[model samples]
Target: MALLSDGHFHSGETIAQQVGLSRTAVAGHISQLSDWGLDVFKVKGKGYRLERGFSLLNAESIKKHLGNTKRAMIDVESVLPSTNTEMKKRIANARHELADGDAIFAEIQTAGRGRHGRTWLAPIGGSLTFSMYWSFPDGYQSMAGLSLMVGLAVCEALKDFGVDDAELKWPNDIYLQGKKLAGILIEVEGQIGATAHSVIGIGLNVCVPDSQYDVGQPHSDLTSYLGHTPDRNSLAAAIIKSLWTLLPKFTQQGFGPFAPHWEALDLYADKRIVLQMGEKRFSGIDRGVDASGALLVETQDGITRFHGGEVSLRGNR
Candidate 1:
C-alpha cells in the first residue's frame, strides 16, 4: 500500500515480489483497500495505483512542526473506525500514562461520526481525521465554551497554513464561503466535581474527490480554495500546536479572551439564521455567541441562547 501510495501504478508481480506475497494474496489485499475508502485503480497490465497521489501521515513530521513542546505521544493509524473511539477505549482502560495533548490520527475512518449521528465521510488521504485528549482541572461545567475556543484554534491554524477564508459557524463548524471545511465533535467523561477529560475530534476535508457520496450539506475542502492540497502532517501539526497552546489559557481564563476572535471569524454573525432543536425551530438574527459560548440569537419575540448539544443552525438561504 505504501508503495502505491505515491499514486503510480506498480505491477502485481512486482508488488508481490516486494512484499513476498503470492499474486493472488496481493489481489485480496487490494480488494480490502476499497473497504477502507481508498480508491484503488487497477489497469490490465500496469497493476494498482491510488486514484491520486497522497502522502501518508508522518508522526515525525508532525512533531517537528510542533517543536519543543511537552512530550506528546502521537499515534498514527492507517485505518481505524474512529480516532475518538480509540482514545476513549484507552482512557477507559485507565491509561494514566496518557496525558493531555496526546493525539491519534487515522488515514481512513470507516465509521467516523458527527453530531446528530451523521456519518463522517473521510476518504483515505482526502481528509484530516484525528482526535486529541485534553484535560482541564476545572469541572465539565466550567468548559462550557471550550468547543468555540477549539473552533477559533482551527481557524487560526488554517490561517497559519495560508487558508485565509475559513470562518467559524456557530458551535462547532468551520466554513469556507459558507460551505463546511471542517467539523468538530467533543466528548467528555468525568465526575461532576473532578477534572474533566475531553476527547476533541476534528475532521477537516483536504482533498475530497468529486464523487457521488452525499455529505448531506454544502461542503468544501482545502483543495477548493488553495488550488492544491496542503500536507496533512503540517496541517495536523498546526492544529495540534494551536490547541495545545490554547487549552491552558482556556482553562485559566475561560472563553473571555477568545470571544472577540470568534466573532471576527463568525460566518453568520448579525445575519438572519435559523436554529433547530429536534422538531422545534426558531428564526432570528445572529447576535454571535455570549461569554459562555452559547449562541445568542435575537428572534422576533426575544433573544434565545442555544448551547451545543442536540441543536443545529442554518443560514437564511
Candidate 2:
C-alpha cells in the first residue's frame, strides 16, 4: 500500500518477486485496488502505477464507518482531477462491461466544478470533493429532487461530526450562519430510455481558509469552523454509509421521502429569499421543496414551484 501511494509505477513481476509471489498474484492485487476506487494504469509490458499520487483514504477505516454494507460496491480514490469527471469515464467504460454500484471519491479535485460552469474552489489538503455514480430506475424521473436528499446526507455527516449548526440553502449549498461551507452538483448520464447513471458530486470546505477564494462569496471549513480538521476518513465513510442507506429509499419514494428532513435543515425555509433565474428574478418566502423537489415559494398571488434548472437561490436576510 505504501508503494502504491508513493506514486511510483510497479511491475507485476517486480512486486511479485519482492513479495515472493507470482506475477499473477501482483496483478490480482492491482485489480482489487482498482475495484476499491484507486485508478491504476496498466501498460501490457510496462507495469502498474497510480494515475497520480494521493493520500490514501484507508479502506478498512472507511469500511468500519460503513458498518454492515458490502465494501465491494464503492471505489475510493485519493486524488482525482474531478470525481464527476472520473465517474463519467467509468460510466462509459461500464457500457462495454455490465456492472453497477460504483462511486468515485477524491481528497481534493484539481479541477472540481459546480453548477452552470462555476469552478469548485477546493485546495489540496484542505477540502473533500467526491462523486457517486449510480444506475437509477427507468421511472426514476420521480427522483428529480435527489440532490436535496444528498444535501441532507452531508448535513447529517456534519451533525455526526458535531457541526450541528450547519444549514442548508435551497437546491444544493450548505451554510453555517451565513457563510458557505459546502456545495453539491448532480449530473446525469445516459439516454432518455434504458439505464441512466446519475453522478452526485460534493465539495466540502473541510479546511479551506479564507485566502483560497477571491473577494466575493465567503467560505468556511470544518477545520477552521471547529479549530481543527475533522477526520477525513471518518467523514468519507459516514458519507458513503449515508448515501447507501438513503439512495435506495430515494429510488422508491423519490424526493418526497426526504422532503421533511430537508425542510428541517433549510436555513432559509419560510424566510425571504431571492430566486435568480436568468434575467428574470423573484423574491418570496421559501416554503421549501414541494413533493417533486421544486422550490415552493409563497408569493402574494399564491404559491409558485420553481423546478431547479438554470437558477440560483440566495437568502435575503
Assess each prediction's global lDDT (C-alpha) against the native.
0.88, 0.76
lDDT of 1 at 196: 84
TM-score of candidate 2 relative to the true fold: 0.78
Return the top candidate by lDDT. Answer: 1
lDDT of 1 at 224: 70
TM-score of each: 0.96, 0.78
Ten residues in sequence with the least summed lDDT for candidate 1: 208-217
lDDT of 1 by residue, 110-222 (tens): 89999877999997788999999988777898888988999999988998878887899878999987788889999997888998889999999998744534588888888
Q: Quick one: best TM-score, which candidate?
A: 1
**Candidate 2, 145-244: lDDT as tens digits:** 8788888888887778888888888788889867998889988888776667888888887766686445258877887878876777788888877787
Query: How far off is residue 271 in model 2, in Å?
Result: 1.6
